[model samples]
Target: MVGLLLVVTLLTYIIPAGQYARDTAGNILTDDQFSYLDEQTPVSILDMLMLLMDGLIS
Candidate 1:
């Protein structure tokens, strides 16, 4: 489990994050508007660790 968590955390840094637009009904529209953000906010290692702990605890 720890190994999997570590892998996922590393992937978060390597993968380019993306976003999708939502319509009035709150449904995600993956049309032309969907795109990979050029500037991705970096997630701190501590934050990722805390998130994993929180998920396990909850």
Candidate 2:
């Protein structure tokens, strides 16, 4: 489990994060509405740890 967390943390740095657009009805937009931004905010190590904990708890 620790190893998987470590791998995911590493991937957070390597991967280009993206966001999906949502419609007024709160549904995720389709491929045509999706856009990859030029800027990617880096996820902190602490945030990653917290996210892992949250995932495990939920």
Best by lDDT: 1
For model 1, name the residue pairs that clash.
Answer: none
Question: TM-score of every model?
Answer: 0.63, 0.57
lDDT per residue as tens, model 1, 1-58? 7788777777888898998877878876857677789898767778888987899899
Task: List ranges where model 1 is wrong by over 4 Å.
Answer: none
The TM-score between candidate 1 and the true structure equals 0.63
Error of 1 at 50 (Å): 1.2
Q: What shift in Å separates residue 17 of candidate 1 from its native position after superposition?
A: 0.8
Q: What shift in Å separates residue 51 of candidate 2 from its native position after superposition? A: 4.6
Give lDDT tens digits, candidate 2, residues 1-58. 7787678777877888777788789876755676667987767778888987898899
Worst window of 10 by summed lDDT in candidate 1: 26-35
Off by over 4 Å in 2: 44-47, 50-58
